[model samples]
Target: MSTFKQGRYSRYLKPFSYLVDLSIINGAIFFFEINITNTYLFSLYISALWIIISFKNDFYEVQRYTKIVQVMTLILRQIGFFALILYTFIGVFKQPNISRLALGEYLLLVFLLVAFFKFFIFYLLNRYRAAFGGNLRNVVVIGDTEKSRQLINLFKKRLDFGYKFRKQFIIENDDFSLQKCFSYIAENKIDEIYASIAELSNKQINKLIDFADNNLKELKFIPDNKDIYAKKLKYEYYEYIPIISLRDIPLQVPINKFLKRLFDILLSLAVIVFLLSWLTPLLAILIRLESKGPIFFKQTRNGFNYSEFDCYKFRSMTPNKDAHLNQATKGDQRITILGKFIRKTSIDELPQFFNVLFGDMSVVGPRPHMVRHTNLYAEKVDKFMVRHFVKPGITGLAQVSGFRGEVETDKDIINRVKYDIFYIENWSLLLDIKITVQTFINAVKGDDKAY
Candidate 1:
């Protein structure tokens, strides 16, 4: 299927999903005999919340690559949010007439009904597409060799990926003419085209762009070796190196990005006020007692768009610890006894709430690397600087997934970069919450690599 067609299908499906939710909500209210002065107002608010959260969660983006577990988890989160909103309103308003049993029954019925409708619709759509002659995307390849064949095999193996391979056109060298290629693409009604960038000439590149511009069809090219950086292409980490391809960032979507930032700001402020305010002073005194140095350590680190900013951390090492750059090793001499405990508990990173407040960082994102380390790793690791596309975070997907502490080996940095890229590509508010919850759990358990 062409990208345009697939997008149109998603648009069509969204309204049906909305109507289904509306029906379920209304049915639940009727079945539970819930009587309130502003019942429709309440229903509208709840239904709107579900739709907004669903969009933020990308629930309507069901595709061949969409995982069942991801969809189910999103549904659960949406339902949980609805429950929280409903209960909070009820409690605050002191609505004694609203029966507790009715509310419980209403929430339960809506949850089950909505889940069933969504799953059944998706299942039927998949079955119908398989059973009948459905609109399958016709894709063509520009290069006829190994890389092209590998891409073909991937699509064939994953039939649910919504791609239908049509044919391959071989372009031998940089001198290959694109005039013929454009003619062939137009005649074939190709929905999408993939080419190897290394094999294409300047003329051919321009032709492909012109073709996409004229035909309103999608044109994606695979890098010869994933070495080039293009903001237009989505990059995924294979350990430390990035696998670049034409894809959109999840965070770039307006609604999802907005909700994510809002969550970050609100959550960061709450932590700063309720938790970090008092804890910072106490930890500052402890650090001062242990070492004759500044209570807080400030260092220049890369933030969003590779912008440099001063990131704060509770001082965890003795005075005169090398500021240039050094990865703290196992039993490092510079790490004081008090430093070890705070680092293990991740308490040292709490001061970054100010970074969050100052808009230099997010509550969750790719962890920032030291300026020296960034310069070093960019040479050692391919696509190392891609993490700077987003603001650095105090805790990130990498940290939660056990990539924290000293990155002593090439492999360690690679793994961390991979997780960080994955986080950026698939970012959502729920993902941030999940990472935060996991970070808390990991802190309590205490990993050997923490200090």
Candidate 2:
């Protein structure tokens, strides 16, 4: 029996969305009677621009498992950008005779209508999938981990998501292998494969990827949160169980990168001019008086793409041979009397603003580790290098969230990498500002791990 059901309608969703959106846009134009010098040309241009904007912002690319919040975000982004493009078109052509109020009303109408239709379709589809069992995907899970079991349960429970639980392959015994899994997939007509990455070897994983691609089946992993994969992966939520795919990083976008770098430059310049310029001299005098070494300490640290850079910091400890190899612990003997004050206040990290200005680091990102520690942790910790996807920061989500200073245990670094990867994958200007504010508050209040 072909269990595919009426899911073939999934293919028509994009086209239907396109037709309805175009109708709503043109219908509003006629209803509003917005004045344009040439009605036909203006209509054509705006309609085409709307399509391009939709594609650009993934407006019509709603997936079965996508959340309503994500749908709202997509609508808002698409409409906001489309509005800007529309106004820019008016200004460029000097369409001063066009009624501004009429255009405003038109845009408001378009947003409301488009959002209504989108939510309506989303809700209707959910009801259809749950009540009528339409648009369901037959899936097989390949592991018995807690996460994988949770996902299987989700497939059986969340009827709206439309994943039909087929079978789970447990690889715990000697009888199970990739060959058997592949045979099962082929026999059962599995539309998607969910694998627990911890249960498979690197070679086995490669074969599974090849098989999935060759068979035209969607493959997703139920990852062990403690381990990191080097491959580019994206995360989606199946009502809270995270699904990983080829990651889409916001910072990788050109505009986002430009904004972050611009913010870094402006903030670093301000700190250098107003604070570090005077504070450095006072600190320099006090450090020279208390210790014999230089005021600034430079160490090689890993940055984006595993590139080595000289990370700068105010000297917090007296000269020691173990500086590069060892991390500063809670009450280290090498920390000078002045070092204690500066370290606790995080003033020692001020010289890093120079690194930020020099473009070696960011104001907010994964905190850089010494070259030696980087090498050690890359081997000891899973996904430790995932943080290297973005430039290292003087302050990061990990640091502010209580994972700063010394690495006392393996679990400590594991949690830190988890937070670092989260920040990198979900970077935003607003998130950066929030983290910066939280960092300031933590500094003022003092951190137990600051030492």
Candidate 3:
């Protein structure tokens, strides 16, 4: 059998693994005397969540060389998220007849069954490869870049990955050309091609891609500046042409995006109705009495995709044209009596619930920066623009972690952006809730900054 055909056996491992484990879950559910009638919906929800989490986590990727412990840990995380989301849904909807007995036993069984089968299957595959090189893929490296050379070396070192290089085509060589690479592939059993795509023109890349497709070969590319990019980017295949647009921003995923928007709407509406309804009027009175400017401060800030929107605050400072240009500092005379109280307590940001309601912001995200700051930071920091991929927030990971208030030095902005990027990349509903709770706790205790 061909190497590609032999290796295709692992492609079904993911779905097959999930299905077997899901059966175990259902069996455990039945044995626990849980009400399966009503909880059928719950079962379906669990299956759906499994697929989503798997896709997001690359759980289906057939990495035969992956450690058993790593696989177990990945499944553990997947199961944990699955459990949390299921229970949260049940609690939110107030679903009845869910026995802790059934859920606990089922989850435990799932983890055990999944880990057992994953280990067993991978073990069998390894043994098979040891006995016969049935799953090995013949590949070629077509680039002179250090990155491509390193990749070839890695393949040579990690023999268990089943990658055998037929030829290493160095573009810098005098005789190296596309025709030469193709001729070599035609003569050898080449299963895949890894080229340093940064060195290839669009035409060359496209031709190589078509050549791979026509000849049933896999074409992979290595960028010259691989270190400058994140590894977790999503590869989108458009009409059989692979285009890596950007890193995997989970917020941009359809389901995650929808759910977050739903959460923002629900929470923002509640805050606006309950907190801001009464609080806004009361703060307006205090501001009018203490200051000469408008009760609400509206400033243009860069939000999702660097679009400028009016970020609402409770007029925390005396209105100045330089509000857009300057960062507030401690004991600044521009801040009135009410401004100081509100800013310190984060009450000045209360009106931003309105921004959330209007879909201008999220309750939890990277805090939007002033247009001036956005431009400045984009220049100073690499990948700083990535923060704008998601909607800005009134309270963020940076703010809750005490990275808020005045930007005094380069380190301050650097740490803030670092935290912001971390939040964007690692976003989850649970993380958002944790950050929200942290923000509340910090507000009660107050921060040294926020002047």
Candidate 4:
């Protein structure tokens, strides 16, 4: 009974959404004297736009378990974008016959009607199910890892989905008793079972299938081999056998990342040609006059995907300063007088524009750690390697958030990693710009920790 209910509700959502869209279009056409041709074009454009944008925003993601406010916001955003595009088209083509006032009123009416309809329908369905106690799907998970815990937490947080989580059954051996688990499932009225495919053997998988078949329940298995951290999965049919493969890196998703890289490359090139070219010469003269050593200090650092690269910085320490990968301390004797000034102003990091041009790093990302320090801290910090998931940067969230100085303790590195991970998870062009602005302010202020 639960299986039938789940399948029916799942299948109904798509057709329901289409009907709502059609109803909105009909309402708009009735209210305004829109040309049939323009109406059809506008409807088609909006339909496609909503579908594409919603998919990108994960609006239809079942796991997201969206709220009414969230759905309303998405609907408003879609309508706004659609109106902007429609107005732009009218203006650019000089379509005088189109009534702009009518169009605006129709857009508002359609948006409000459609959003309210969708929200009301979902709300009523939820209330009806709750009234009858009919919508809850009992689920059992098969693992206890962080991933499994995450799944459990999502279900718990999203109660509107009406999922009642059953106990997580730990599978110990290939020959575990399926009969006992099946009996328990029947008694508990389990609607579905989710298992980590990597943790279960062939025999256990078969047992799960048999249990599902007997109880008429659904079974879903999570793949274990894939790096779940990377958002790249494609479903394809090969000889009628469906296979899922990692699509592409999320950073290479669309014009967004490409445009970002282009911006980085052009900006880095400009800085190198106009700013660094003159500045490097002046800094070289100052360094040579003050001390007797090279103009740049090249050190090996971990780049994207844990790759080793030589990071270039204006020499800020005296000759033969490499002692033990030791970070600079306050009043360090090895730092030259000019080096102190350059370090304080963060001008010493200007040489990294060359590194950016060489594709060793990005303008904004997790700041790269020295190779030796990376090795040392990987053992000390939890999930430290996650920082390598993206290219290292010259300036990062950590730097802007006051974690940019010498990491003298485990806590400093831990906080730095926390901020870096946060940046990676919530990256955007706006965020990059914000970090860059903050970094500039910090640079100008010459905070004591900058040294």
Question: What TM-score does candidate 3 reach?
Answer: 0.53
**True lDDT of residue 399, candidate 1:** 89
Over 4 Å off, model 2:
1-9, 246-451
Q: lDDT of each prediction vs. the true structure? A: 0.74, 0.84, 0.74, 0.71
Who wins the TM-score comparison? 3
Query: Per-residue lDDT tens digits of candidate 2, residues 189-250?
Result: 77888999888898988877756533445688888883476655667778778777654668
Backbone clash total, candidate 4: 0
Highest lDDT scorer:
2
Ranking by lDDT: 2, 3, 1, 4
Residue pairs with backbone atoms closer than 3 Å in model 4 (clashes): none
Candidate 1 worst ten-residue window by lDDT: 1-10
Residue-level lDDT tens digits of model 3 in 1-451: 1111112335466557768866765655665655445667767777777777776765655465566667777778877887787667557657676666666777777778777776787777777665676578788888777667777776776566677767888877888789888878867767668887777888988778656533445566776654555667545331223324333567866558767888888988998889998998998888888778899888889887566799988897877878878878888888888888898899989889889989889999989888888777776765566676689998899988878988888888889988988998889988888998899888888888867
RMSDs, each prediction?
14.4, 14.5, 14.7, 16.3
Clashing pairs counted in every model:
3, 4, 0, 0
Name the candidate, 1 or 2, with the larger lDDT value.
2
The residue pairs found clashing in candidate 2 are: 233-247, 234-245, 234-246, 234-247
Candidate 4 lDDT over residue span 304-398, tens digit each: 65668899999999877463387788888999999999999999999998898888888998988877888777667765766775788899999
Return the TM-score for each candidate structure.
Answer: 0.50, 0.52, 0.53, 0.51
Give the lDDT of residue 88 in candidate 4.
Answer: 69
Steric clash pairs (candidate 3): none
Model 3 ranges off by over 4 Å: 1-233, 242-246
